[model samples]
Target: MGVTLLTGASTGIGRSLARRLAARGEAMALVARRGELLDSLVIEIEQAGGQALALPCDVTDRDALARALASAEAELGPVTRLVANAGGGEPTFVDGFDSAAFEAVIQLNLIGVANSVAAVLPGMLARGDGHLVATGSLAGRRGLPSAAAYSAAKGGLANLMDSLRIDLRGRGVAVTLLMPGFVRKHEPKPGRGKTGRRRSKPFRVDLEYATARMEKAILARRRQLVFPLSLAVAIGLTRLLPFGLDARLLAGRGRRRPAAAQPPRTRL
Candidate 1:
């Protein structure tokens, strides 16, 4: 296996996936904005007899991202697989529409992937072998209550990956899009949402569960993968409903405004 380069490797899903890939003896280049965290992770992997190079990067910056990719190739090896897993979004509400905030989300979730693809695809095309993996979300399937910005960003990413998958077919570069739902830091607990009502995450899974399935799909080069099955099925059913009805059904769900800013983590 050639070097696998992953962004957002400091925490959450990216960190989990990095650990799993390392355990499987894959030499990797870990990228994240937090250099200290990346260094610590590198040390841990090295102690475990796994090879890893920590390359601090912010995926939103195209030039910086390109430099990081080049460093990965120089230090680890040619990156045969690129996981564009760096993204985060804040809730966007109709009552308080912030274009700057919305653009930030789009930049991270959509343009960030584009930057990563631009940086890596040329080499993959030249070599005729590479895998491009992106972490999307079930929220991308449709517009959510207060996640207008996030939903739009993820939706755009889904289409971008789909288009790339179609265009790159038979070209030796594989594109895999992973759509996961409700990956929480811990077990679900009942809590009051923005509407001041108790809410629960349906069919939520932990980081470990999400990482295992994602790793399998990435390794197998699956075209598109959605999990967990229960949530995917439920979201699939929602797609068939009339837009008006679907909107009504989910209006009360996910209406809570997140903190002022959220760090790059798994899509919620």
Candidate 2:
């Protein structure tokens, strides 16, 4: 199998997913801005008799990302799978809105994925075989009060994947979009909380559980996958509500929680 190039591979979903794929004997091209973490992950994978190459890169930088992809292909063979999972966002409040901050989130979450696809899409099209997967969020489906920027960026990504899937339908390339809600930053230890509950959000799930579902969807080449089912349903229902009602319903949800206050809902 050709190498699977995964961005944001130093932590959270990308990190865990890399290990899961490696266990299946697939070679990996792990990309992230944290060089040390990537190196350590590489060592861990190697120790397990798995193949992995750490390519530290900022997905938002087009030229740098291209170089990283080239290096990955040179070292581990063609990358048959591209998981554009690197992204970040900060709370945007109407009271103190910052255009520059909004742009930064857009660049990282939307343009970054575009850059990644630009680097590998040509090769995938030429080979007529490949998979492109992106980790979006259910937040993208609705505009949360303090997370407008985050919601906008992920919303754009979801639409981008939709268009790509339609465009690549007749070709051999496949596209999959993952929309997850309230995924925990770490795995919950047994007896850590009441019934080992790590988060209070409804249907909140841990990293390992979330990544397992993502892995299955990618392997199955599903067009779109949303979880947990309860949260997905809630978000989906919001879309059917009147604009005014929907806005009022989520008005008190994300009021004071700055985006920086929590780990990125997506990945790096």
Candidate 3:
């Protein structure tokens, strides 16, 4: 198998996908901001007889990401597959409207993907064979009340991937978009508080299952993949409802109080 470069490989869905690819004996370069986590994951993969390189860099920094990609190519051979998956989002508060925070989210979630693509596209185009995959979200399908920034970022990402798919067609580079909903990192422990309970997200799927489905899509070169059929159906149904009624329904659903502002965790 050709070497695959995966961003956000330190945690959550990125980690899961790396593990799955490693198990299949695909050589990989794991990229993330957390050097320690990348090192640990590299160790685990190597111990299991997989070839992997730990590349610690922020995807938001184009120069740093480009350097990391060069290092991976030197060690593992040219990266024939690129997973542009590093992203996170803070809730956008209409009351406060922090433009800085909104801009940061867009930079990380959308521009970060663009950076990853820039790092690999030249090499892929030269070779005339490669795959580019990105993680989008079902939330991108429509705007959510409290998650305006996040929804916008994801929606923009989905469109970006779609445009790439069209442009790259017949160019020997395939683009795939993974649209997942509510992937739970871990199950919440019992007996926290109402606040903790409210923090818990719904329609969650375990990492293993999500990874498996993602792998299948990547291997099949699917143009778009949306998981957890139930959530997809629900989101689809909402589109058919009357605009006023749908708006009211969304309004009736309570939103969690905004937490203190902080950078979103660098994970998908």
Candidate 4:
């Protein structure tokens, strides 16, 4: 079987997807900035009777990514699937401006993804057998106030996947845009854990459920997969709302809850 290379393989959805794919007997090349984490994941998968090659390379470094791909091919095989999953950005408002943070966000969230795509796609096209899967967000469908950079990057990613699908349609390579909404990775929701681990509160859509949906879509080469029927509906409504109202409605969801209002205490 050809290798499946996944970026951001250290944690969250990327890690989960890697585990699932490996369990299904898919050989994998795991990529992430965290060397130790990638090593651990590879060991776990191998111990479970799977094959994996851990590659610790910063996606933002284009040459590093290319080298990593070469390494994977040498060890595992040609990558038949590319998962562009790593991304991060600092939340910024127009008032509290930080140019450095803004640029860093754009570089990591946008250029990093593009670099990964460039690295593996040529080989896939030449072989005429591979798939490109990317993670996009509901925020990409509309502008979210404090998350301008985040939305912009994901939106670009979704569009890029679409264009790539068209550009390589005849080559037998396909692209899948995995669009998700509000994934709560920091905390687990109640009832999510079987071993009594603290589960995060359920966000717009549960990650596990969404990942399964994504897997089927990828296998079928679906152009796009957006989750949470209601959320998609809400986004549809956004297009119809007047700017003043829509933006305001979208603004409140991302607001930081003020630190618990402290009561004034008087000591006797």
Q: What is the TM-score of each candidate against the true structure?
A: 0.91, 0.91, 0.93, 0.87
Worst 10-residue lDDT window for candidate 4 reads 259-268
**Which runs of model 2 end up more than 4 angstroms from their true locations?**
187-199, 255-268
Clashing residue pairs, backbone N/CA/C < 3 A, model 3: none
Model 1, residue 78: displacement in angstroms?
Answer: 0.6
lDDT string, candidate 1, 21-70, tens digits? 99888898998999999999999999999999999988899999999998
Model 4 misplaced stretches (Cα beyond 4 Å): 186-203, 257-268
Candidate 3, run of 10 with poorest lDDT: 259-268
- Measured with C-alpha atoms, the lDDT of residue 149 in candidate 1 is 84
Which one wins on TM-score?
3
Q: Please report how far candidate 3 places residue 245 from its true position, in Å.
A: 1.6
Which parts of model 3 are misplaced by more than 4 Å?
192-196, 252-255, 259-268
Ranking by lDDT: 2, 1, 3, 4
How far is 127's C-alpha from truth in model 1 (Å)? Answer: 0.5
Clashes (candidate 2): 0
Clashes of each: 0, 0, 0, 6
lDDT of 1: 0.86
